[model samples]
Target: MISAPHKSSGKTLVSLGVMYNLVQEGFSVNSFKKGPDYIDPMWHRLVTGSQCRNLDPFLMGAGNCLDSFISNSDEKSFSLIEGNHGLHDGMDVDGADSSAGLAELLETPVVLVVDSQKMNRGAAAIVKGMQSMPPKACIKGVILNRLQGARQEEKQRSAIERFCGVPVLGAIPKDDALAITERQLGLTTIDETADAETIIRNVGEKIASCCDLQAIRSLFSQAPPLKTSQVKAERKAIASVSIGVFMDPAFCFYYPENLEALAKNGAELVFINALEDASLPDVDGLYLGGGFPESFLRELSGNRSLLRDVREAARSGIPLYAECGGLIYLCSAAHYEGETYPLANVFPFEMGFQNKPVGHGYLDMKSVCDSPWFAKGERIRAHEFHYSKPFDSSEIDAYQFEVLRGFGVTGKRDGVLRGNLFASFAHLHAVANPGWARRFVALASDYKVKGRCAV
Candidate 1:
């Protein structure tokens, strides 16, 4: 496990570098990221050439987290898990849901990445504090990042080893070339970055030159063998149904498990490039996940044919679902940077952006009314992070979800229901909401059989 004392401590970049280096060494590395994040996992996927699964203790529970880790780690040469935020940071006061807790649960030793930008001796103090903290993760080694010179490196390395009793595996000099660019939503998607592979390759080369590969690889041996659980596939409801997914630069925030679950529950996913595709494919249902749609306003707005096709599909009562960025694209118009652009116009409200997040954090919501996707009175544990909101907040009164915690569209309700369309700012995970995939496929099947107005 790769972790740090706090966020922005170079843990993510270090984790990616380690994965890249290991993959270059002819090892089939399976990587996992803690918490609900799409950006970091995308970088991991790019480096390892495999889908990086998320292990969120808050959403998936401890049992399911174990199951997912074991199921995905089969027949792999190595497995690397990246921690989010600080090692001991979490919503729980006892630190039960922190990355350290996850390390303990998986029985994996953590490699701490300390940013040595300011002080040398202070780095060891932070390490000592983390080592003695409750739910202390078994930190086997430390990597000093953003170092200045040999004097600073020697001091930090000696202090950490002597005081904290942990090996200093590496000391990386401060280099701006290794930094990844960021936007409002975190690191920009790999699709949007033209030199993404080049960046990963450079990072891998640098880390390989600095870090001790042998010592780091030995940490994998320290982890006890996890008890494997039997992963049973959900029973297929229908033979098959086609589900169109927007998967371009504009709308690429999708969980791998969600796509896998859809396929497992008798849905053949038809991936569509919203920016390039002229029109929608022949599919029973459509899914639009969260992404940076605001960045491609002109390009998306210029695609009139595709926009009309999507608007027509909504009007015809096709089972369409959209999340944060998807919700933005479905709006009649979007105002960003003093410019307005037309979109699919599935809904009547105008979308507007803000300097800060309108709703950011784990979301707790209950179904207020029955929709094609959810039943009334059913509770859902999901998450939402969005900077955009509708201009007419009153339109959210007819939404499906009653917000129990965290801000929703109207600060009270979410899950906008119109015809057979269910759009929301909340992003659902298949593992947390196990019935989502089956229900989506079943709805699509019903629509296929009953034609327009099937819901």
Candidate 2:
């Protein structure tokens, strides 16, 4: 597993570089990300030409996390798990959801990527401290990043290996041109990057020339294998129901398990790209997930047919579900970059863009009003990541959920309801909420039979 002393320490870049380089050498690689990230995995997928799965220790417990890792990763392929943030940073001071905790759970050796910019011996102290930190991290190696020259690399590498007792597996020199662009969120998604392939190739060649892949492979081999449970697929009553999901470069933040859950509950999944398609198919209902709608507001606004279709669906009382960016799309307009862009306009609210995040963490919520999905007073555990706010606060008071923990649409509340529509900033992972899929499918089936007029 690849980890770092802190965020922006070239963990994703190094992992991508190594992955591309390995693929160049004809190795089938399966990559995994250690947190609730939808973007980084896209870059990994572009590099490896395969789906990159997320193995979040917090969203899924250690046992289920390990099982997920085993389930998604190919046994014959090389597995590369990348950790987000620092190895020890978690939800609380106890470090319960830390990368180190996940690594220890899988018995995976960690290769700490220490950023060597503007420091040398101090890097060793960070590694040494991490090695002895509680949860007892097994720091098997180190990768020195942002080195100046051969002399600096030798000094930093030697100091870390000498003091921390972990070998420096690689050294990436300081090159501003090599770094990926970043905004309030992390790096731009792979599809958004124009020269992503070229960038990955260049970085991969550089990492291949610098890093010892054989040693990295040895460290991967040291991880103890996780035992996965064999649960048979259950057939359901609504086998013919097809659930439409909005998926594209604009809105593609979906958990693989979420789609699988819908499938397991006997719903046929159909993906529609709002940026391209003009209308939803004759499916039972729609599922619009969270993603970077703000980045493609003009294109989304230009898609008038799709906008009209979604609005018509809302007016027809179709059972529809939306989260975060999906919620932004369903609003009257999205105000960003000093301009207003017309979207679905299904609800009576506008979303105002913020330069910084309004909500960014785990959410504990309770249904404050009756919605198509959740009942009143029903508790929910989900996550929120957004940089926009509901522009009309007075209008938003009619929404459903009250935040018990973590911020939401109006600091304490979220989930906008219009007819059978359910829109919220909090994203629910179906793996964590198995009933989410069942309930959503049931709504779609009910819509197909009796229509969602009652909802």
Q: Cα lDDT of all candidates, in order?
A: 0.89, 0.84
Name the runs in model 1 displaced over 4 angstroms.
Answer: 233-239
lDDT of 2 by residue, 28-48 (tens): 999999888888988999999
**Model 2 ranges with Cα > 4 A deviation:** 227-239, 452-455
Q: Tens digits of per-residue lDDT for model 1 on 246-358?
A: 99888988989999889888999999998999989999999999999998999999999999999988888889989999999999999999999999988889999989999
Which candidate number would show the highest lDDT if scored against the true structure?
1
What C-alpha lDDT, on a 0 to 100 scale, does residue 236 get in candidate 1?
A: 53
